[model samples]
Every structure is written in C-alpha cells, then in structure tokens.
Target: MIGRYAKLNVYQEIFKSSDFYRVAGGAFLIPVALLIGLMSNTAVIASLSLKELVLIVSVLVNGFPIIMEAVKGVMAKEVNVDELVSIAIIACMLTGNYLEAAVVSAIMVAGALIEEAVSDSARQAIESLVEMTPDTATLLRNGREETVKVETIRKGDMLVVRSGEIIAVDGVIREGATSVDEASITGESIPVNRLEGDDVYAGTTCVDGFIKVEAVRVGEDSTFGKIVQMIQAAEESKTESARIVDEYAKWFTPVILASALLALLFTGDVTRAITVLIVGCPCSFLLAGPVTTVAAISRAATEGVLVKGGGYLENMAKASSLYFDKTGTLTRGEPGVVEILPEGGRSAEDLISMAAAVETGSAHPLATAILRKAGEMSSSIPEAREIVSETGRGVSGMVGEKRVEVVSSDAYGQKGLTTVEVRVDGDVWGCLCMEDEARPMATKAIRDLGAKGINDIRILSGDREPAVKRLADEVGISRWHAGCKPDEKLDLIDTCVGSGLIFVGDGVNDAPALKAADTGIAMGLRGSDVALETADIVLMNDGLEKLPFLVDLSRKMSRTIKINIALSFIINLIAVVLGFAGVLTPILGAITHNIGSILVVALAASLRYSKG
Candidate 1:
C-alpha cells in the first residue's frame, strides 16, 4: 500500500516539473512498480502457472537493464541530459507509476533525437565554403603551366589563366592583364580592370583579357584561409541563453530537492516526496534556450550569414551604439579620383604623372587610383627604387636619384584638401585631388537605425584626421575619432559599452576593437585576417543595410525567449499548486505537465524557422 501510494506521488511530481528527463525517468519506472504490485497481489490469491511465470520473467528481463543503468548513473553523480530521465524512472518504480514512467522516457528520447537533428543542420554552411574554391587549376610548371589541384599549387609558383579563368592565389600579375571580377571577395560589382604589376586574390574570376600571376600567398595563408578560420571561430562562441539556463538549473535542482523534502516532512509520505523529486528534473527548461539559439544559427547559415557562437547572437540583440570603420564597413574601401586641380604653374597631367610615378609600388586604393589616372594619360612611369610607406604618411620612392613623395595632404602637415600636392625633391610640382565616396547603402543603414530608435553612430579610424573627418561628414556621423591606433580603437569601444556599442570593421587591426565591442559586425566581403574571427556578426554580402535587418531579428528573438520563459514558469507554478491540493492524479498530472514542457520547447525551436 505504501509503495503504491509512493508511485502515485512520483507520477504527480513528474507531471508537475517542466524538466523532461526527470519526468521521463519517473515515467519509465512506472511499469516495474506496477509489475511488482500485480505479481505480489496475484501470488496471495492464486497459484501461478509455469507459462505465466515465464511471461513475467521476460518482461522483467527487458526492463531490468534500463532501470539498473538509471540507478547506476544517479548513484555515480553524473548529471548529463539523460541522468534526470533515469532518476524519473527510479521514482516511478518506487511509487508503482509504471505506464507513466515508460511514456516519460519515450518522450525524452524523442525530444533528444529531434534536438540532435536540428543542431546537426549546420553541416551545410561548411560544405558551402568548401565548394567556393575550384578543385584544380593550371600551374606554370616545366616552362609550361598544366592543370593541377588548387591545394597542390605551392608558394612562388607561376600560374597562367585564360580570360574566363579564376585567379587561384593571392599573387601579383607577372604577365598579361585582365578585368577581374572580385565581387566574390570585395563585393565590387563592376569588374575591376587589372594590368601588369596589379595584385589578384584567390577565388576571383578573370572576366576579360588574360593574366599570368606569380603566387604570393598560398594554401591556408590566402584570403580564403582567413574566412574558413572565421567560420570555425564563430561556431565556437557561446550563447547567453545557454549560460543563464545553466545557472537556473544549478539553483533549480536544489530548490526542487528542498521542496520535496518539505512536502515529505509535513505529510510524512515517501510517495509524495518522490513525486516532488521526479517533477523537478530541470531538463526541458535547460534545453529551452540552447534549442532556440541552435535553430536560429542553423537558419542564419542557410541564408549565407555565419553567426560565430551563442554569445555573439545574444550580444547582437542588445547592441545600442554603432561604431563604423569607414573603409569597407561604410564606404567601399576603394578610392577614386574625385577631383583634379592644377597649381604651381603645372597642368593636371603633370601632377598625375608625378603622383603615379611615386605611388607605382604602393598598395593603397588611393595610390592605385592616382596610378590609373596617369596610365590613362599614357604617361610613362619612371623606374623607382627604395620604396617606403607609412600609416597617415603616404608612399615615397627614389626615381633616378630624384626623391619623389606622394603623401596625403594631412600627412604633408596640411589641412583637408579638395586637392593633394605633388612634390619632387621638396619642390611642389602640381596637385592631384581625390576623395573616398560613401557606399550607396551606408546612408540607408544609418537612417534605418535612427528610425529604429538607435540614434547614436560614430566612426573610429587610423586614417589621416582630415580624411577620417571628411568621410565622417559625408556619412553624417557627428561623433568621430580620427588618427586612432589599434589599441586606441579598442579603448574607444570600451568607453561606449554603457551605450551597448556595435563595432563594424574589416581590417586585421580592427580585431581587438571588434572583440571588445558589445557586438562586432565584420564586413566579410572585405574583412582581413583577425577581424573576421574576432567579430560576432559577419555581413557575407558586404551590405551595411543588413545591419538594421539583423537588429530587428535579434529583438524579436529576445522577445520570444521572454515569452517562452514566462510560459514555463506559469505552467510549473500551476502544476505545483494542483499537486499540493491533491486535485490531480499522478498519471494525469505527469501527462499534463509534460505537455507544457513540450509546448515551451516547440515555441523556442520555432525561432530557428521564424521569418521574424
């Protein structure tokens, strides 16, 4: 009679608690308790046949291992996801709630399988990245290039490609010229014209002409290598919801134990105590947050957006202020000749020739722009030696023993110029002016943030103060920090933490700042080595406008989490009340309580597929 009552109470607890494992574990115990009670009752009333004995033995044989495992796991103090399910079985066995125990275990196993399937859905993202690079390309070998696996293309190898071929590595154009479509790497839609001496990135297609490139970076050192690293780093970051759930479970288990003990003391009923223990397993509640995050991450990967970890996702939702790195993040990192002014009794062509000759060896976008303008004039470049470049300060080279300098106006110690001076051996030759145009989407992203009540926007850059200020003015960002070093950028981010900053950057130097910000948005299309890995959100399409869309999505996800948590707490509260009042049977209570847990899980998982 005592055991039967105990079994009933156990079922009641399983029904009351939102923890799936504890409830399921208790449910599995029900059949064993039922069999024991039935056989004991039968033995006293009638003689059992040998065939009947065999049938009972078979049922016990099937159930014994499962029950034994559960008991062993609990005794060993191993609290895995399955551990609570085991304890639930034990509770059901003691209370004679056989059917409820089996049902509970079945539900738990099913839910676990579903969660596993959903989490594994991330395989597609990695596969998509792998498919981006071609399997093989022609390498210049034995005085003539032949087809070979892209992976086998070693450093310093020369590769020849036709007009329609993709560039296989980060290399300089050793021979020929072509218009390369770098839309895959820099998101530049207009096919960029390349020539002898121009650099090409791996995975970029040669849209027009033909070029033989000498490999500079190969294998894992290429841009593709950094992207793969970013994908892996993003996958490893943790989510805030999972952390909170852990803390909740830590306290929840103890509280449940206390409640069960109190109920046993007051009523002097072991069955009632077991019921409380079974009900408070804390499994489903623990699963609620991770399931939602995993689902959202899976959905994002399908859309070509890679969120690094759970923590990144959570931070993006709460981000307030946005710190934009002007290059790549706000403006196309490319610079074009916006204006040309003549000074010092010289023409625009003279200034262009001088600037281009000095910048021929430079890698800056502005330098390239100047060089192209000179090339358009068919101006011959002078052979230069002893080339040197400095941040803020521009490129300087010795052309035929004549010192030539092509520095930004700010670097020359002059204020913002609609025109830059060209100097030869410390005498002004002429001026060639240029400016970086803001990306078409930059204005819209800022406006959208304002409309969404995120009013604060700032720019932090290591570029010349004048250039930084000019770009900031163009973008309408009033709060700006120019001439900042890498460490200073990180400090600026830390200062903005009270406002919940979102840092957007694409260079390797921006990595520390990105990691320090509340949410780091990497412009993946142009982002450098460390920036991609340290960032939380990656704009794969290089669209700054996606910022608003992601912000809205994060807010919606946060709201969903709140709703699920509220529902879980309410259901648990109601079940507890019903159990204390003796208004619910162990079997009905367990079933009803589990239904609520399932509902919470379903709602949380829905976030993954939600268009919101």
Candidate 2:
C-alpha cells in the first residue's frame, strides 16, 4: 500500500508539472462560467442549467485536491489550513452558493500552486549542486585507460582527467600540470594552477591541461558530496520562527473551528460563520517565515555563502560582535619569506634549503611559505629524517648529518615579523622572517561591518603580540588578543556569547572557537576540514569581502521576515474582524484570505532579488 501511494504521488507530481499554466487556465475559466450562470438566458446552449454544471465541474476540479489534503491532515490528527478551507468550501456549497465555492477553491489552488513554484525555484539551487557530480570517470588500469562509472572507482585508483572534463573524484594530481576551475566547490571564479602533488577536488573541471589524479575520496565521501549533503540537511532543518508558526497553527486551527461554531449559534447566520472559517485559514502566517528563509538561503548559496540552516541565519543576523582569526581568516593565508638571515657565515641558500627540508612534511601555512620559497629559487632541498612537530612551537628533524630545528621567536618577545629560529646541532644558526599580508579586502570588510552596526570587531591570533597587533592596526580592528592558544580563543568566544558573537577562522586550531561562537564562518577554499565542519557558514571562495556582504544579507533577511509576519498578522486580524461583523461574505472572505497569502509570498520572493 505504501509503495502504491508513493507511485501515485509520483504520478500526481508528473501530472501537475505545469501547475501554473493549468491553475491559471482554470482560474480564468471559473469566473466566466459563474458570469454565464448568472446572466445567460439562452435555452439551447447558454442555459442556466449548463452554466451551473460548469460551475460544479470547476469547483470539483480545483477543490478535490484540497479536500483530499484535509482528509490526510485529519487522519494524521493535525488541524491545518487545508481543513479550514475545506470547511469553508463545504459551507458555501450547502448554502446554494456554487459561484462562491468555485471561485474560492480556484483562488486557493492558484495561490498554493504559485507558492510551490517559487519555493521550488529556491530549492533548485541545492539541487543544482547535487547534479554537478560526474557520472563516469576514465579509470586507468593495466597501463591503459577505460571509462567506468564513478561509483565503481575506489581510493588510490588513478583517473585520467582531460581538459574541459569535470574531475570525477577528490584526489591528488599524480601527473601533468593543469589549471582547474573550482568555482562550483570553492566559489573562486579564477582557475587555480594544479601541479603534481597538489590536491584536486571532485566536481571541479580541468580547464587547461590533462592530468592523472589518484583518487583519495570517491562518491559521497568527496568534498562536493559533503556540500550537497549539508545543503539537503540544512533545508530540512527548521528555524525558530517556523517552529513557532507551526505551534501557533496547531492551536489556531481549532480556535477558528470553534469561532465559526459560535457565530452560527449566536447570530443564526450560516454565511457569517462560513466567512469566519474562510478568513481564519492562516495561510499567510504559515508561509511567511519558511518561504523567506528558503529565498534568503538560496540567494546566499548563489553568492557562495552556505548557511547551515535557517536557525543559523537568524542567529547570524542577531550577532552584535565579530571575531576573526589572524592567520587565514584576515590574511590571505599564504605567507612568503621576506628575509632569510643566516649565522656563522652560512649562505642564504643553505639556510633556506635546510628550513625547507624540515618543513617538507608539514602542512602549516608557514611551512608552505618556506617550501614555496625553495621552489621559487629552484633549490634542491635535502631530505629530512625523523621529523617531529611541537604544537604551536616548532619542528625538528635530522638533515644530512646535522640536527636542524625551526622554533618560533615568541619565547624571545619578538614582534612584527613572524620569525622562526633555525637551530643546527643545538646552537641557533639563523631565523627566517615571514610575513602574511592582510587580505586586500580586509579593511573594507571591517569598515563595512562597522557600518552594519557591528562595532565590536576584534582579532584573535596564536601568533606573537606584535604581529597580531600590526595586523589589527592594518585591518582597522581596534581590539585584539595575541599569542592565544586554542583554549584561550574558546574562552574569548564564550565570554562574548552574551552579546552574540560571530567567529570566522580557517584552521584546525580554530575549530573549538568556531563551535563556541554564536555563529561560526569558515573560509572554505583553504580551511581545515575540522573548522569547516564546526562552522555554521562557509565562505566558499575564501574571500573576506563576502563577510560584509553576508552580514548585510542576514540583516535584510531578518527585516524581510519581520515585515512578512507583521503583514500576515495585520491582514488576518482585519479580515477576521470584518468576517465577524457580517461585512464579509464567504466569497469576499476567500478573496481576502488568498490575497494575504499571495502578498506574503510576494514579499518572501523579494528576498531573492534583494541587493544584500
């Protein structure tokens, strides 16, 4: 029976695929039929009986689905707007008001169909993400390549991706160099160059050259797959406003039924009671919050901001303070070696070569900087053995018959540059000074946040005080905390929770703080998995400019929601009062109720085009 019902639902959806056109056609014909029924006096073709038959047919065609929905709601023990509308239609029909019943049913169906169309457009944003995954891959096996299903490929399988082909799995480039367009996943419009050993993700396209990628994650475990999953989960999650509206509807439906009964008993007027039922349907109130949320979230997705859920969107709008991590959040996250000072007559080449050798196995931004410097100079760095890293301090390894260590200069109270001391055989040899430049839009983002009324913008960093302070000054942030461990950042987030804090970071150490904040935003392109998982929002392109835009967008969404709710309540109150006063007939009540629903839907749809 369940399977049969599912099949029936599928068929129903298929039949209603062109719902707008069908509903519009039906709505246009309904009033014409009613007018003919009232005005026609012809005996042969335009007879009164023929017009009455047309009205009855129109009412059944438009109102049958609504009646079925009400029945389903009752079976599930839920009193909803459908039941109220069904009652109103039945009352109109019993009172010999076929015109009123037909028009009311047509309007309600048309309104619902329009709302569904708009909501479906918003949902398509997430659906598009799911559709981006490639179905097939060119799998390399036994010295030859053969096309195979992406699902059949396993980890460590080498896949040959040609230029203009979508990458089939998340992997590392094992051969060839290419520029991959990762806009779908990272939201970065520019294609990034990928060489041997560079990571490539699924759903990205190879735009320039052919490359062989060794698959690391396939199917649903890939980064693209995870994003799709998150979006689906987000859509299913309800906001506080939606929950409140649902609770209100639960009690309000019964109250409307009772009020309708009271009107009939006290005034002995069937039309007034039916009007009361029609006006108290709560259609606008039910749609106001969720539709706005869907449109806002869909708009955010199009702009490369992925809000986890409507609840997070609401909290993000309420955030009064913003906290940013220094390394990768405010800065470009790619630091470069500014100066390599050697000691004991060591050449600059020797110093950098040794540093790069020890840093080869590390993925830290500073390590990447040293490795990048070595690559730029085309220097042959010696291999390091028995390498070990000390958390928040340094890395040590044995390089070519000598013990090498790169330690942070924080112990010496150094400021400004991020300096790392190189120790050879237990004596300090030299220090490599690196600088991570502030993001180009960092200042503008901060200023814009201030303009958005978020004055408590602060910086938190695990770097030295001088370096952090310098960056804070550069970015125009007035408050900063330097040399902060992960726990300290978490503490700061906890303290600021009362004021509602937004923490933005992109490192493993930032995960705890991200989870502690009211709303956590992660830089998606370069962020650690832990940080991304913990964050409430992900800036896919790793752009700081999007931060200010997101803040403004959240505020606009909040305002849109408020306006929609106010308009819905006001319309409902006025309609109900007029309904009780006998000023509204059943037909007028249905028109007013549907108008309120249409207005709320229009307001919610406006969020999709809002500038913010």
Candidate 3:
C-alpha cells in the first residue's frame, strides 16, 4: 500500500532532495485531490476537509526535521527537543489528527533552521582571523632558502625575513638589525629597532631590515597559533545568560508540550485539542532570544566589534560600572617630551641633546620618545658609555665626562607632567618633562559613555599620581588611582567582582586584569597576544571611541531578546485559549503554532538589519 503511494517517479528528485517538498507534497496533494473528487462527484463538506488537509500538510513537513533531530539525540545519549516534537506529532497522527501533526512538525524544522543559520554566521570573525595568517614561510637549509608550508617548518630552522615581509615565526633575531613596524601587533606607529637577541612575533612586518631568525616555535606552536587557540577557547566558554537560557529551555520545552496536551484532554474535542497541541509547539518561543542575540553579535563583528558570543552580548548591555586602565586604555601609551626646561641659560635644544644622549640605548617608551624628540631638535647627541637603567626609576650614562640622570616625575617630586629631570655631572643641569597625552578620541568616548548611562568611570594605572590625575581631569573622570602594579589592578578587579566591571587594556601586562573582569575589552587594533586572548570583547580597530556604540548595540540586543520572549509567550497563550474553546482542531492548531514559531524566529533575526 505504501509502495503504491511512493511510485510517483516524476517527483523523485523533489522527494529525495527537497526539504519543503518531501513532507508536504504527499499530504497536501492527496487531500486536495480527494476534496476535488468529492466536489466534482457530490458535495460532502469537501471545503472543510480541504482546510483540515492543509493544516496537516503544513505540520508534517515543518515538523519532520525536528523528529529526525530527536532520533539523533537519542542515539547520541542526549535529549533532543526536536525528538520530543516528533513524538507529539506522532501522537496527533495516531489520533487521526494528521493536519495538527503536519503543522507541528513543519514549524519545528523551520525554527531549527533559523537558529542554525544565524549562529553559523555569528562566528565569522574567527574565520577572518584564520585568513589573515600566512600559509607558507621561507626556510634556510644548508644556507639554501626554499618556500615551505608553515606547518612543516621546524624549530631551530633559520628563517629569512625580508623588508615589508611578515615575520613567519616567534623567535629571537639571530642576525641583522632593522626597525620593525609592529603596528599590527602593538598598535604603536613608531618602528622598533630590532637588533640581535630582540624577540620578534609572528604576523608582525619587517619594515626596514633584512633579518634571519632561528625559529623557536613553528606552526601550531607559534604565537599566532596560540592566539587562534585562545579565540576558540573563549568562544567555547559560555556566558551566564546563555546558561540560564539553556536551563530555561530544558524545562520550557516540556512545559509547553504538557500544556498543549492538557488543553486537548480538558476540551474533550479531538479536533480542537489537536489544534491546541499543534499551535502550542514552542519553536518560536525557543528561538526568540537566541536569534536576536546572534544577529547583534554578527552585526557587531562587521563593525569591528568582536563579541565572543550571545551571552556576553547580553551582559555588556547591563554593564553598570566600568573600570579602565589609565595608560593605554584612555591615553596614548607613548610618553613624548612635552617640556624642555633649560638651565644655566642653555637653549631647549641643548638640554634635549644632553638628555637624548643619556636616554639612548634604553628600552623604555619614555626614553625612546625623548630620543625621537631630541633627533627632531637638530641637536647633536654625543656617544654615552656605561649606560645604566634604574628599575622603576630612570636612566643614567656618561655623556662627554658628565653624569646625567633622567628621572621620572615621582622620583624627583614633580607633580604635573611625566617629568624627565636632566642632571649633568651629578648636578641638576636641566629638566625635560614628557606627558602622556590623552588619545584624540578619549574625551569623546568618555562623554558618550556618560550619555549612555555608564557614569561610573575609574582610571587605574601604574603611572605616577600626578600624570594619572592630569589625564583623568582632561577626560572629566572623577575617580583616579595611580602607581597601581599588576597585582594591585587585579586586587581592584577582585573588589569589583560582585559589581559588573569592564577592564580595557592592550598590553601583555594587562593579561591578568583582563582575565579577572566581567568583560575584558581589548583594543583589537594593537592588542598584544595576552590582551587579545584574555579579553572577552576585542575592539578590532582599537578605537576606544567605539565604546559608546558597542554599549548601545548591547542594549539594543537585550531589548530584542525581551521582545522575542514576550512574543513566544503571547503566541502560546493565544493558541492554548483557542484550542480549549474548540475553535481549532489539533491539526489546525499545530499548523498555526508552527506559523507563529516561524514568525517569531524571523522577528528575532530581523535584529541583524537593525541600525546601531
């Protein structure tokens, strides 16, 4: 009997491949043909029968995928929501409520498809990172260089890196010297001079030097590989909200099923009860929240906002307090020479020249900034010998038989600028003060945050108190703390744990603090490996100005989730009432319920197109 019904050959491809056609085609066409035969032969309420057939066909096609999913879940030692829906459909079918079964089944499939599509696209940022890495590297074997797959390159292999070339591995520079532009890595524009023994990272470009490095790590062991691993790990870590939603669904799905069944039993009308059960399928209700969240995440990625997942997206909206690291987060990390106080009636150039000589051959950012400034002053710098860098203090060296010290402001009791005191021959010769300037967008970002109701802003830094206070004043921030070591920052984070806290930072030093916050936002444009990996949210452009926009997006997504949840509940309520009133048959109820589920999912996904 089933073989005769299955003998349709012209539609074989449709049955085998088409998702929509296979489930609905048979049920729909069969009932419609019967109705037409009855009408042509003799009228016998054929129109009402056609309505029931339409309902059944809709439920079966939409609900089949759900049934299949449930079967897979059972086989895999898991509970499947789709399988439960399939069970409900089977019950409707056995009771001769074919219309209800078809509607319920079809709706379940549509909801699952919607959720799958949105979540798949949400992780596109990870794919973007994968595409940015180089696939091959140049390896030197027996002094003969050859291009090889990056994965095949082994440690201790000497790799040649040319000017304008991306560094292929993380290793110490074994030979050659050149200035490397690590803007892609550190977000700093100034090219860093790399001599032998200087560590170089993968993905950074060699701007002006031919260098060879003995690779200590290659392929998946490289720094870039670790970053990819971190990204994957972070994505796997679910936020609290997502967990809540999962728990809610574990109970919500079954509750919805029981309610639909109860409505049918109490009404004592087979058709109306079936309608209630079919309409009460919780597909739309289940999809409402996730769809909106997924859409928000996807849109944020395109705008350079890499939100980790749907759960974080929801939390960011509710962020009431924000704790920011002072140095790189709110201001330009570089400390440039802002003031050159010449003593003994000497010109600014003279002090700068004297200071630059002492500051040269130093690794500190302030030292580099002063040297660069002195070079621009057209002041000749004499060679300094026995150069010494004092830990947490300043640098000293012999400049033409004169002893000079360029100490930080706190070291010399200076209060305003990040001062660099210049002394010649153990006597105070002059002062060259450098200030950490606020970023061009810092003030605007702060103002926008305030306007968005994020009024609690605090600046914590390892810098001196004066510099910290000055920067906070410029940005209109009320709370400021300076001289905070890495541990101190973590302690502060621990205090703020119960309250929502967001730590914004970009350096490797900020790793601990980033990991301790409610949401760690890394300046993606120039974040270090530690920052990128530890931080939950990565701002791709590293534009602190985008903070306001991100907050706005989060709030909008939260609102969307609320709306979806509400709609799901409202639809279920209406379907239950109608079913018990005997206004809908089981088959019709399932079809209507499936339609509602599809509509809810569509509404949730519409968040993708929402304007920020």
Q: Provide the overall lDDT of each model, using Cα atoms, as 2-decimal numbers.
A: 0.64, 0.80, 0.68
What lDDT score is found at residue 145 in candidate 1?
A: 64
> Which residue pairs collide, candidate 2?
none
TM-score of 2: 0.82
Arrange candidates by lDDT, descending: 2, 3, 1
**lDDT score, residue 472, model 2?**
90
Assess candidate 2 and give its lDDT. Answer: 0.80
lDDT of 2 by residue, 153-216 (tens): 9999999999999998999999999999987777677899999999999988999898999999
Indicate the residue-level lDDT of 78 in model 2: 64
Off by over 4 Å in 1: 1-84, 94-97, 117-237, 257-279, 299-305, 340-367, 370-432, 485-491, 525-527, 579-594, 609-612
Candidate 3, after superposition: displacement of residue 210 in Å? 10
Cα deviation of 359 in candidate 2 (Å)?
Answer: 10
Compose the digit string of candidate 3's lDDT tens values, residues 1-612: 011111111112223445535544644544564465457444336544554555555554555545666677679875445544566677776786564465455444443343444444444444554555678888889979999888787788899998888887878899998788664444355788999998887767889879999898776666556655555544444545446656776775566567666765776655564455455555565556655565566566556566666666666788877888877678777878776777788788878888888877787888888888987877899899888988888888887778878776554345557676787877676777777778888888888898888878898799888778888889889997899988988888888765557778875568888788887888754544555566777775567877888888888777876776787778878877877787766546655666666666566556656564
Question: In model 1, what is the error at residue 401, expressed in angstroms?
Answer: 24
